[model samples]
Target: MAEFFDNYGALLAQGTIDTLVMTIASCIFAYVIGLPLGIWFAVTAPGGLKPNTAVNTVLGWIINIGRSIPFIILLVAIIPFTRLVVGTSLGVPGAVVPLTVAAAPFVARIVEQSLAEVDKDLIEAAHSFGSSNAQIVVKVLLKESLPSLVRGAAITFVNLFGYSAMAGTVGAGGLGDIAIRYGYQRFQGDVMLAAVILCVVLVQVFQSLGDWLARSIDKR
Candidate 1:
């Protein structure tokens, strides 16, 4: 074990960093696109704040189709678009394109669920106060649903972390890539074990932080 660490410690360290970068980048991108999309989804649903069934239905279908595609297939299938967006289909930046695309639908779904969980009474009160639809969503629904949204974000982040690892199969340059290249391809069990341990540690740290944030935000 000591010998193994001595041999591939640097590589594992690099892989860990790559994995972190990919996960963080993807999470940010996913939220940037997904949050508004989710808000739109909620507001446009039948009898919602804005209630545009046609727009809601179309957007819902798009989100569903995107979500239905398996990540691996999505990764491979989107290669052309990925390259068009990032000019390459490998490494951290290249990986971000597919990661964000894959993550957005999942994040949107979570956001929609969180927003839906906001009390109907609160929305009604905001409306009674002559609040605009946008104002109510921004001030009431979002503020009230923040804790749940944070929890949902935590779940989405962890899911993206797993996807980032899977992206390594396409040379995305993360711990997953390291595991595949050195662990599986080169038959290095130590390297694979190290990568797996690193991933587990990352997930634990995120989970702990997320729980802390959720608890801190809980006024009740």
Candidate 2:
């Protein structure tokens, strides 16, 4: 292990940073797009207070199609668009484009599920108070669902971390690429093992953080 660190410590460190960069940036962008989208889906779905079948169906289809494609294929499939967005398709910036795109729909679904778990009675109560649609959505739907949303955000963050590693397969520059190129291709088991450990650590850190935040903020 000392020998491995001496030889590849800097490489591993850089790879870890790149992975975090891709994961965090992608998650932020994805959630920014996904939150409103999920709210739109929830509010417009059949049985929703302001149901719109046409709008809900179109958005659902689009989100499903986006989610159904495998991330690896999505990576390659959107190369041109990635380049268009980031001006290159082989580093952190390039990876961010695909990562954000791939994660947004997934994040949307997560947000939708979290919102779905909100109490219908609370929504109705807010309605009885003469709250506007926007007021009920913000104060009741979103405020009540905050804990679930935080947990979902953490899940999305870590899941995107793994996907960012896969982006390394395309030279996106993370531990996954490092592990593949040096560990698998060159038969350096120690390097691969180290990368895998770092990934596990990341997962644990996010999981714990998410749980703590949810517990701290939850009123009931």
Candidate 3:
């Protein structure tokens, strides 16, 4: 173990940083796209305040299609697009594009579910105050759904963490790549074990933070 640490510890540490970078950057970008898209889906669906079937239907299909595509397939399928955007499809930068694309729809679904859980009474109360659609969505729905949203964010982050590792399979730098190249390919079980432990640790830390924040902020 000491020898392993001496030789590969630094590499694993760098891989962890790269993985966090890819995971976090992808999450920010995914949420930027997903949040509004989710709101649109929620407010345009049947019985939604704005109830527009055409808009809802189209958005649903698009989101569903995006969610249906497997992440590994997505990682490969968008190689050209990823390269076009990042000018390469290997390493952390290359991984970000695909991770972002892969996560957006999943994030959207999470957001949709979070919003769906908000009590209708709260929305009705907002409407009673003559709140505009935007006001209700922003103030009531999002605010009330804060805990659930935070939890959803945790789930999304964890899910994306896995995707980032898979991205490592194609030379996307991270613990995944290290584990793949050294642990699996090179038959370095210690390296693989270390990489897996690091990933689990990262996920647990993130999830605990998210859950704590959600609980702290929750009023109800």
Candidate 4:
């Protein structure tokens, strides 16, 4: 046990950190792009505040196209774009671009769904008070949807975690990389098992925290 720990412990620790960095960075960037897009989607739907069918249809098709691409394929296909954005496509930074790209559309959909669930009565009440679209969005739609948004964030994080691992297969450098290198290439079952176990634990932690946070803030 000591020999095993001494041989691979630091590698695992660094891999975990890299995975986290990729996941967290990807999550932040994905939300940055997705949140406003989602608000636009909800606000411009047929029965929405603005009701521009053309804008919604175009955006919907774009998002659908983005979401339709599998991450691995997207990862390879976007190598040039990723390299242009981050200067390389081989590490934590490199992995983030594709992860963000892959996740943003999904995040947008989640946000749209959450905001769509906001009580129409609340929006009507806001409108009665002469609230502008921006005010209603910030003060009413977003406020009411905070819990669901948090939950969605957690889901996004978990997904990015998996994506980060997959990125490792291509030299993105994380637990996935470690698992592939030591566990698979070197035929070390123990190393692979440890990496898998750590991944499971991290996922559980993220999911539980998300659920707890959503529950704590949910008024309904």
The number of the candidate with the highest lDDT is 4
lDDT of 3 by residue, 42-89 (tens): 989788879999999999999999999998998999999999998998
> Cα deviation in Å at residue 188, candidate 1?
1.9
Off by over 4 Å in 1: none
Model 2 steric clash pairs: none
lDDT of each: 0.88, 0.90, 0.90, 0.91
- TM-score of model 3 relative to the true fold? 0.96
TM-score per prediction, in order, is 0.95, 0.97, 0.96, 0.97
The local lDDT score (0 to 100) that residue 11 gets in candidate 3 is: 96
- What tens-digit string does per-residue lDDT give for candidate 2 at 33-88? 89999999998988776999999999999899989999999999899998898888
- Candidate 1 lDDT over residue span 55-92, tens digit each: 99998998999899999999889999999998999878
Candidate 4: regions farther than 4 A off? none
Stretches of model 2 off by over 4 angstroms after superposition: none
Give the Å error, residue 169, model 2.
2.6
What C-alpha lDDT does candidate 1 achieve relative to the native structure? 0.88
Q: In terms of TM-score, which candidate is stronger, 1 or 4?
A: 4
Q: Provide the lowest-lDDT 10-residue window in model 2.
A: 164-173
Q: Where does candidate 4 clash, by residue pair? A: none
In candidate 3, how many Å is residue 15 off?
0.7
lDDT at residue 17 of model 2 (Cα atoms): 92
